[model samples]
Target chain A: MTQNRTLSLSGERFTAVYHIVCKPAEAEARARDICVEQTIEFPEALVTDASIRDQIVGQVLSLQAVGEARFEARIGYPVEAAGRELTQLINVLFGNISIKPGVRLVGFELPESLARQYRGPRFGQAGLRALVDVHDRPLLCTAIKPMGLSPVALADLAYRLALGGIHLIKDDHGLSDQTFCRYEERVRRCAEAVERANRETGQRCLYLPNVTAPAGEIASRARLAKDAGAGGLLFCPGLAGFDAMRALADDDALALPILSHPAFQGTFCVHPDAGLSHGVLFGQLNRLAGADATIFPSWGGRFSFTQAECRDLVAGATRPMGELRTIFPVPGGGMRLDRVAELSDFYGRDCILLIGGDLHAHGPDLIESCRRFVAQAG
Target chain B: MTQNRTLSLSGERFTAVYHIVCKPAEAEARARDICVEQTIEFPEALVTDASIRDQIVGQVLSLQAVGEARFEARIGYPVEAAGRELTQLINVLFGNISIKPGVRLVGFELPESLARQYRGPRFGQAGLRALVDVHDRPLLCTAIKPMGLSPVALADLAYRLALGGIHLIKDDHGLSDQTFCRYEERVRRCAEAVERANRETGQRCLYLPNVTAPAGEIASRARLAKDAGAGGLLFCPGLAGFDAMRALADDDALALPILSHPAFQGTFCVHPDAGLSHGVLFGQLNRLAGADATIFPSWGGRFSFTQAECRDLVAGATRPMGELRTIFPVPGGGMRLDRVAELSDFYGRDCILLIGGDLHAHGPDLIESCRRFVAQAG
Candidate 1:
């Protein structure tokens, strides 16, 4: 497990790199304060023991001034301190200090012992490609729209979209267990509809249901979706917690491709010099938590994510890290049919081009619109 | 149940208010787009049916131009649309729109039918006061510190804090199932030590262990804490989704008071006009998720929460909601013994004042320092 080597070498340390923007004079003190705030949040006097001070306390590795009032601080935390758990790792990385401004988590360097504990991406890009039987083209995915539609109506839309050649169809993140469209009913009808359409058209179309619910109901719902012939599961890790998504990915019974939808998560990445970077928050963290594919607002969309941030996100998903598999970055939110070729070229075949409302805009013929989207992408 | 009244009232609608900052000319268009983006996310033509439009589409209620390019918009959604679930409710409230900048969720008004589904705060201000038997005075809560401490050392600290008449001794949020101090061992020893100290001093001091873990282990850990004789559970709702905290709170077997800690959640409320308001995110939402006490960084701390926001949070906790009990507003993060009286006066009797590292600086004698803290607060 590499545990012996990690433990033997300077008390099992993992480096946490933070992008800090503060007065150059205060950068060193701020970096030290981060160490204390994240670890032994007590005064220096309380840390009576030498071992606690030397072994447990975070050590500042390097501080490089990037610009005026901006410095990048690299700090090392004892790997044993995080217990090799995602939740605790996040806590050790940015727990108490997240309350303070001007400290953004840019990257992390996990020791082999710590990184081995996580099971990242059960069905990554290749697995997902195999699931949908899409070989050499960017996959076309869309969301069943207009929340508050009855299960029957939504399933009807799913049937048409599947028949028209969209490879992956998922419930809009908004379509939860509402009264008008209950989760079980929606999953059952939509799955059957997609299956029926796939059989008729001789195409492989997957219906991914949103299984985000109360903590108790999440697993059961995932099980239900699997039993109902759903191809994959969609969840808002931001709302349901990243660990919840990891739990589903790690589960044997409901072992299906999981797609993470970004909802109520913008606050973390929206700020330039606070919170986390796009690559770390959306890409690396999502992949580490076992997302087969992650959905984000595309650049040139209504959101504020810049082109550079989008590129970084792509890099994060595809980058190599230990045994973690590379994941597909699905870009949506204001993605249109005409831009399918442009986005396909931009993201290449590894990406899933998600076009939502724009599919409906290409006339009342939803099937024709889907066909055009697939044809354009190919 | 008020289901009849809520259902009968013209489609059971609930209003979500947002504070938006944009160009003066774009205010009206932005408000309309929010309704579309949050609800349908489809082309206007696809919302062909009038009934679908009326029931599903978010209707803009009011838009007031507050300042130059700053406006407040109120939008209504069908209460049934949320399915009376916290996850869906949050999605319908924020969801895709959260990615858009300049739009901040200010407040929400849920219909009684929707509100009744949530069991907010199993033990509220009065219930907690009854639990600790400290009816007239503010509660004294201190976090057992220095993350690298073993279970035995932390238990000893808990014992000393309890002997000194501290009402609640909690593991610091950072002490989450780490190899240095495992969860079960720490809970067992600390709970026993606190119990022994209570017996010796004839007090009701309680030990609250941090039970935050992976998604699957949370409930079991809560059960373990209860079985170990711990008085309460501390979890970072932000790190381990809010629903996880709600699940622990809702569990009948482990009916201990649940404390919600703000670990990686500061970004949501730090911004003036980009994320959620302090009252809604920290107060109302935490209460809805059944946090007996919600801990946040207080004003005049290392964090940046304002005085007005703190007051708003208290009001959101204690204000009358349908059947939800009023929760305790725990003001923490750099709280001190000297300010106990001032904070007590500010928050009144129904508050928990958390003093962390400062308690140790008082003297080498931990018990005497705690005694002074308790005496000062009283």
Candidate 2:
């Protein structure tokens, strides 16, 4: 597939592919408008010099009309224009154009220089597998549920899940620093409970607390979780900025495997021709932001993500991309224990199967349910 | 007129209203599911005690069928559930539920106790008006554009715009700390030029530099802009987290008014029945996060926002609320100088009219164009 056309630019440049749905007659004009909008956002006369036009302005590489009102426009931006920053790269990709309708960001072809700048996934699939000592099968994960539960109650649940051989136990994204369960107390108790369970069961079970908080408090909260002996961290990169997760992953003091949660990120992938492709938003972007495992609404779940989209996401996570490590695609949201075999076969061994509410449906025996979940995945 | 339905058993509870478009037969089930998904994401048996059910669980206040397959569901949560934090409040309102389709967050009825906790808009509409000394007329604002320009060129542009009596001069959200124009050098030079222009013209023209950066560097950049004598700050809250803006607003050291640039936020407001309402996402949320002025693509512009949606946004920004100050709705994106009269008449006096690329098209003289813009708004 000839996805991108080479632009004759002097310096390092990266290609950005967008799925534009507009009138076929207007496709060419719209493509030019995007190139101008993403760069100058001003009139043509503002380009005082030709070098600015050649170097700084985005160049349209290709424009192919796929459907009646659908065109795939590939534009190339100078690498220097991005300044090698993730936020700036995103701005260059779809910043102002996002406000305009009918433009959807589908894919990115980062130059080696630009792609290597981002330290993608500190502890990726292999590292996580090594950490949990679960190499031959899909990792079993679940959320410690019932938001109003006390720190003690949640810790007890974590302990039971750990003893039952779940590889990763994460906090429900709703579990923030609420009065009912303060962050520090909850982290300490949950970490201790998981450690106790690990000691008894002779297994490396990890407790990942949701550290999404006010920007200033996020680092401190992560530090506190680490000090409390928590194994990993779960972040809602959608609610908090994706860069926050990258910062935590890069932090030397609290170097733990990070899991990206898709809480408020649905808007990006929900629309067919507006925001971003499921593979790019849920898979590539999350991996680029240093998410060891990226969680999304699985197909046949409560959410509306399709099976094809989920397959694309898996491909995006494990695609060959320079030195960036492949991360785990944690399919979650309304996943059931009964579907464990099917999910494992579908996603293969390089995935994390997250089963939530259905774990409690088998009876009041949480431990037995979790064991059943682990066995089914195996 | 009555937007909220009071919950019978409530102590300082807040109401969250969602516009749900689902099958009439499934409206009740979907509403109940939302109440569960937003709060617990667990099964019913997880609610061990009645107190837990009453306090922790979200209660449906009212469900009114609006259309054949549309229903308005209002759910109430205890104010304490949010922990008096903006991030937590968002999580409580729509975290896990964002992935679910046919649900849109329309309105939030925050109690005084909850609303007052956020230091919303340090310099709100009145405060900004007082700062710029513009009364009985809409404020004139424009972005200093042509992204590849040098710092000196940008400073010259800022000087020309300030001399023309433009109230607010903001960096095009695309202008970040790039090699062409470093953040500190651009901010310092622009602040000096604006100050020099202000001194000569005897006008209070504020220069707001775009301080959107990596999570850790945001505060330092904000501090640099303030220390460089920049009058206010421009933040892309969509790219950076909203909490980052709130932290800057709440920072005692840098108390400058913030103007939020709607760069990557359009995804949430574009879809009608998926993400968020025009008023809630762009207006109420921006005010809550401490944007003294919020910028969005104006109606009939290059963007797809409608006039009615713009009106709703204005109302959401300026409407009476509990202690949260009213913010200015700065409408930009393809606004032409010729439409100043029509826009002014439609948006009324409480708006910041942003005229961008058109200012450059009128003539080579930017100052003269800005003067004409100011005169037209008047």
Candidate 3:
């Protein structure tokens, strides 16, 4: 309902702040005009205080003029508790109007509601540390990937890896419902095999399936895997939108810990200053987004991430913010089994050690092979 | 099956040219093992041939090592017809894998097959010149947003904005699936309104609507709108994935021009020489991704892009690479109407200028109000 105050008056954001740049000083009024047209669809007189406008959107922060023809304006919104989190939020902030030439948004100041709902990591530093019983040692992990494998084929590998004492065994990000491996079928078979193996060998290996699709299908999929005896869900918040993680966290019944994957999340970590700081974005935001453990490319991996950047990522994932404990940083891609100690020393016990291909290299007799690797490392 | 030769025995990506960083030497073997594991899951003997891998995945120039733990990969695939259309190949290269992580592709090198498909503006450079017949003068555009509007309400505003000769009118990205204006109903009504306005004023103002959604639904929605007489479709490839845009371009039946939005895409643009250079990402890559026009946060908008970054975007959108002309750069976010002339001069007339809130502030009579604002600027 604040739409009236927002539209007609100079004090409201519909008129207050914008990085308006033009030769004529009339740009402010023009900018104000734009605010009404974009936010309310009508002038002050047409809208009312109780209208949805007051609730759906609000002013974030505004700057007068920083550059040439540009102004920075941040609009605020209550955090979405349901579907399509990041996508919906981004659209609300700047969507169709983004195509207009000569306008830019240089910064954003998130409201506490949105910030709180982001949920960062479902299990922070202490939580993940408690899960694997590894304190002050890099957490060990790996992926069963290259897709195209049958459920039994992948399960055999998972069972072996679990027996080897690897802390986590994630399905490859590509393991969607391709003819090679149906999602539910694969998760079911693999979970059973791991359970059986763990019973015999007394090793704890968690299986995290990559669950990403449209908003509606996500929670159901998570529930399906959990019901099928799976340990956790690997959530691609970037692909599914960050808020999806929070929704999972919000569910008391479906309280499976989440392992956040960087799939399609390059935009957040790719840019330095323009998007979010490493600590704020991956650390604070991912935790807010409800990630229990978050994965990223590490230094000395197949991907070219510098030590400082990797370190920053580690710090972000493990930093304490408010009541949230912080997330575990899992670094993978081209990691070798032998260097576990080095990576562990670098990231301390608050990290998830991800070794993808190295685990696969121990082929044929999966149990014996993985047992040696795990014994040598973790 | 070159999987073995290319991924295993070859080691270090030596047979191919992508030099992703490797430390302790053994990491290269692990990465190769991953390629071997992911591609030819059954045996190490397969997946060795680059050609076989191409058959399944597509062709590519090379995957390189960008900064530490980051990679700069260049993949080149045919444009379905061409001789190095920079635009088409980028689509075929990583369109499938971008959804997965452990991929930090920071750079690209396009070939001719891809170069030809990057058709900028569709009505770009010269074609748009003939439409409004404004030679060397900048064009003005505006947005219709805030959702919750009835189809009738939306159409009325579209009618007025179109009659004002604003050149373009786009829906703000948030106008999707809410109770207010559903996709088909709103598109049909808005298109009719724009057409009616054209009949009255003899002016053609284009309406671009955001059509980003789940996988199968995307193509259906695009075709639906095109059938309903839509001029172009708006998509944030960042949200829907690049494949969605490629799907639109490849559809000969639904050959509507596409305007790419930068909603969740700002994260990628915020980096400096990190994820992807803006020229390569928004311009060349978007062109490759099949966007007729690419929208970025203009330097002076509510976003953080500096002036040099904005101008670079213009060059990225318009500059030529082989036969494919550059895409049109539609800079936007918190833009005002009064600065049209300045923006026009900076970006040239081939662009679509966008303004939002300013037009509504004109007066009570929406149509007359729209006319006065457009008149004042020109």
Candidate 4:
């Protein structure tokens, strides 16, 4: 079982922090196993290449007891293992280890070389503000919904919402290219309606169509949205891969801001002790994958996310990460018009205030309701 | 908030079974909430259109007590809601509800029209058996491993494994286009090496290269593998979106048998009362999304999958689903040669027996170990 060659150890390494839930005696062993499992995926004893053992296998930089029967271990892996791609970086981060229980990836620190390789967030917080011509207050955003609505009805709603000064109006993540409202017709009518409203009101309201489609059609669908005058794009990185979102962001031809929606991604963060933390998935990862704004369930909503978790999520979105621009943390999910002031005070102007169904509560004249929402949000 | 129009509902519908964990008093409310949350996403009180309520919004078909504080709820949604795409089907199935706790998607039943829409496995069990010309026994598969290995070293291993009578030799999922072994070079050399071995041995051994690259590079890389004479393709539907795998499976140009690797997909199945059941994620979903063979961590392995869970996974893979062909249930992850008989009895001949690191144990003489694995497996 002897190898003929010794591969060079790539010097640059990235660190990942994991919270391992185990007994005091099992902590060290579990940490060591994670190091081996994430990297080589082979028996360490038989790895005859000493350099492979020393350099390639994950190095446990530090480990400490965080809570009863839980230990936080910081492990470093060579940047080469990531293959200098976001997809592979994620694979190296949590691939096979995700199947195992009690190993939650809390946070990570990538080397400068790897961080620079990804083109994150084309139109981040400042860029989004520039697009909407609003810098003083939180950007007011809404989703056009009730799945069975015809394209014309959806367009009418978009027109009114745009006239009322909503900065970013996006399609509901559930509104794919369904038969009731096909993607092309819906995007075209909404974009035109929003544009007509923008012309009348002198507001730079952006219509973000949900371009999340099948893999083959995603890029073409995005191009169609852009050609149809879509102001931005709403993508579900959880449903379509994170790399798909990154690819969308990095495409210079389709240079529209991207708003990431949390659809199938909830499994990664819902579990406290097994999957990722809320901040890591919705905040850091979303920004790194090139989302201009990332949407998640806000606290006090119908969803179960707590206030502390929401705060952590906000921090992760706005935190400094090399040269990557800070993305807007758009919090929605059962948000209300009455809570607009309280949310504004807590989230500050860097956030996008997303109120969906509640906008209808102030309706009859939906435009007037949106205007009231804007005034209250400010 | 009244709509101007009522859209028609296509009669064909799909039923999704969810395991809802809540207090006895809250079970009905939670089940109803899921139906609304998964479909229209708007507040039900505001959904004034009665036909929209009756047709488009998910309808709870039945609810039954499953366990303590756990109830099984079968909810049906119009097939039109799925948008005739695998990606949208998943979005409609788990999308927003993934964020909510206590909702586990355990099973689903799609209408014949919807099932017929997807191009499932191009090379199913029978097709795969024909390709290898082996029908009487369980197929033997091994992964070339140790992340730092060069293309030459990997090809050498492939040559030996092929000579020793293994049916399939796939690149370790970790062996993406790393600088140590770029995908093009690795695929070319390994394909040539395996072909040379087949010439001498007169046994059909498929060298499946790991074609899981970043979104932009995946199709090109898959084409390169096929052009270079690789026998099959290995993909991580979880890493690259499941629809990406489906796209590859459906593509007329680069049509190769795809082996689905469970890398980043573990989160969907790990939680006991949340996420998806092992059968749904690994078996049914994989087949629906066009995976010819689905690899999972077997019970008694380094991973935490139990024997019961593995059996459920096998059932999910081979169960009758409209016109969709049955796929191979590959159980790997630290599987050993000694357990071949037990696994063979349990999984039956329709499965692919994947033994990774253990193949090196009877080694020094690697080919001999593979031969012994084949003999024991048969």
**For candidate 4, what is the TM-score?**
0.99
> Per-prediction DockQ, in order?
0.52, 0.45, 0.11, 0.76
Model 4 lDDT tens row, B1-378: 546487777776899999999999999999999999999999888888787888888988999999999999999999999988888899889999999998999889988989989879998999999999998899999998888888888889889989999999999999988887788888999999999999999988999998888888889998998999988999998888999999889988988899999998898889888999988999999999889999999998899999999988988888888888899999999899999999999888889999999989875999899989988987
Please list all clashing residue pairs in model 2, or write none if there are none. Answer: none
**Native-vs-model 3 lDDT?**
0.58
lDDT, residue B4, model 1: 14
Name the runs in model 4 displaced over 4 angstroms.
A1-4
After the best TM-score superposition of candidate 3, give how far the Cα of residue A210 lies from its true spot, in angstroms. 2.6
| Candidate 3 structure quality by residue, lDDT tens digits, A1-378 | 112222222222211122333544654554554344344544455443444455444444433555565455544333331113444544544443333323333333344444443454556667766766666556678777544445766787787788877778888765655433567888898889878877886766678886664344667778988898887888766555565566676677877778877654544544322344445445555776678887777788655567887777766665545466667788776687777777877876567778776655555555566666566555
Q: Predicted chain A of model 4: TM-score relative to the true chain A?
A: 0.98
TM-score of 1: 0.96
Summarize candidate 1's per-residue lDDT along A1-378 as a digit string, tens digits.
001111122577888889888888899999999888888887765677767778888999999998888899999999888885788888888888888988998888787888888888988999999888898888889998777577888889899999999999999988888766788898999999999999999888899999989998999999999999999999899898988898999998788999899998888888888888888888988988999998999898767788898998998898877888999999998898888878988898889999988888877788999889988988
What is candidate 2's lDDT per residue for A195-287, written digit by digit as tens? Answer: 999999999999999999999899999999999999999999888888888899889788899989988888887878788888888778888
- For candidate 1 chain A, the 10 contiguous residues with the lowest summed lDDT are A1-10
Candidate 2 positional error at A253, Å? 1.4
Candidate with the larger DockQ of 2 and 4: 4
DockQ of predicted model 1: 0.52
Per-candidate RMSD vs. true structure? Answer: 3.9, 4.7, 9.4, 1.1
Best by TM-score: 4
Per-prediction tally of clashes: 1, 0, 86, 1
